[model samples]
Target chain A: MLPGMTTRGYHHGDLRRALLDAAVQAIEESGPAALSLRDLARRAGVSHAAPAHHFGDKAGLLTALAVEGYDRLADELGGAGDDLLEVGVAYVRFAVDHRAHFEVMFQPDLYRGDDAEVRAARDRAHAVLRGGLAALPAAAPDRDALAAWSIVHGFATLWLAGALPPEAGRDPEQTARAVIRRLFE
Target chain B: MLPGMTTRGYHHGDLRRALLDAAVQAIEESGPAALSLRDLARRAGVSHAAPAHHFGDKAGLLTALAVEGYDRLADELGGAGDDLLEVGVAYVRFAVDHRAHFEVMFQPDLYRGDDAEVRAARDRAHAVLRGGLAALPAAAPDRDALAAWSIVHGFATLWLAGALPPEAGRDPEQTARAVIRRLFE
Candidate 1:
């Protein structure tokens, strides 16, 4: 429970969620370079060391964010049902919508890779992608999966970085669907 | 020239190359987070300030490396001689061989983005890719070019990040070629 949190007067059953939310806001405004536990605590209206109790360190907080991101991504993408292309589009959508988590999740150097929670969360997300890939035709599923994953991931990553062409005109979700369709064609 | 380096010393004309070489070695050893101009100068047996004379700043040094990388990539892809798939394969090869530059070039925040030299070099590389893409069949050239570039760039980026499956057993160049071939199929 951070000191200045909106739920400061309460025992705040979900202090962890509050911290994570504050982290995302901080990351969005300052980028990953300025992430700080004390600032997070201040923003959350808890004691300066409250974040340390929950996350242990900056890396621990980042690991937690990565885990949450993976879980959310897996849930969103998995819910796309039988449509592999839809799942691909959902993956891109998750990235765009959760920019802060998406940014930290991929930069392995920024988090504790060996943490069991992080590992399990990451594996869960990967399983969703693999599952979606398996839904494709069996003739050359592995290759097709790799191609599909590569295009969607690449496009989403580039688009977030503002490297994609403006003339493409299609929104990120539409662009992802268009690219994934070509993979099967 | 960084501090302790001298035009009158035994290594002057070659010192710039030596410093760049040392920078690559450092990036490989510790990743980009650990890169420091003073550290590079120390490793090169020069004073901390000596690097400034040659590169002006850390961004300048990185920009120089990026410019060199773009030139090398353009040359390699150009040598593929108008075969779109071959050019795509060459793109993957460049990413693998020049891992340091490939990593830095894409991370726009880490370099001097407004430098004319860097922009020119990057544009030259883009021209090579665009030229090869233009050689594809006339129908839907715009979409085809975007797809072709996306697949090759996506494959190379993912492969370099160790996200691709090792059990696939296919070399990067082969995988790149296969992915690109799907565009026309």
Candidate 2:
């Protein structure tokens, strides 16, 4: 078990958190498609059935993770305030910093996107993104929002996938700021 | 076997294409990380060793697929005729039309991105996109190119991930045209 995780603390509320941390580790080491609940149980140093007892199944566990991811994203974007450029930079930073969460969050096939908590958290994140867009002129703000979202999301996704060329540089946030400035400036 | 695929045609120059087709099918059904040489061979209706014989390993097979993806993308973008907006639209269309290939191509961890053939094909695609950017003003063209690429790539990826809101509308090419216009206009 990772330090701070406990196999015997299920009822005390630490086990669920431990299992999620283990799941993140597993996903970072290997992508989420290979994730199995049984493996998570072993990683958490709990009973074979312990993961199922907490999450019900793999999708359930992933749903919880996705919700957490969105909540984190919402917080990060919210912290960037109303500067659209800063919000875009913050979005890229979130993807690079919380890669495991970012990976699982976008892949809806791995989790229940319709789950109430997931939708709530996702909407919160979306609202934060949209709030930054409110500063733009009202001429087709929806399309502007979509364009803004796509550029930042693309930069983040490409950076994470290692698809960008070497000249794109190492710092995602700084690179994203430059790319985003081309559009909104 | 999919129509036109054969179980007995190993050396007639058709098996390689047939196996790649099966791999695309398998990846469409499941994501790339779950892909295996043995499973692909089974799906191809060939000896379990056939996939390894043709591609050497799973990464080799995915590398081949990524090369094909880039080639096809280069062709499509090249055909878009120097208009950056059209090239962006074509990029989105390619992603929507070739989901399996698109999914595998971007996830560089699943394949040998540095392979000579992969690099050549990917460069061809990148050059096509860059050619479209040549029509813009010379000031900060690199950042402009990066922004344009990010918006289109991000839109296509988000569309594939089903992460876009419903009001964003269907017809990826049309929606992409509007989104890409926001940056270049």
Candidate that scores best on DockQ: 2
Query: Model 1 residue B17 lDDT?
Result: 86
Error of 2 at A72 (Å): 0.7
Q: Chain B, candidate 1: TM?
A: 0.89
Error of 2 at A14 (Å): 1.1
Cα shift from native, residue A65, model 1 (Å): 1.8
Interface RMSD of each: 2.5, 0.9
lDDT of 2 by residue, B66-117 (tens): 9999999999999999999899999999999999999999999989999999
Off by over 4 Å in 1: A1-15, A25-48, B1-13
Residue-level lDDT tens digits of model 1 in A1-185: 56644346634447878888999999877566568899999999888877898889999999998888989999998899768889889988998999999878876677887789877888888788888877666566667767777777777777776666665665888777777777666
**Predicted structure 2: lDDT:** 0.91
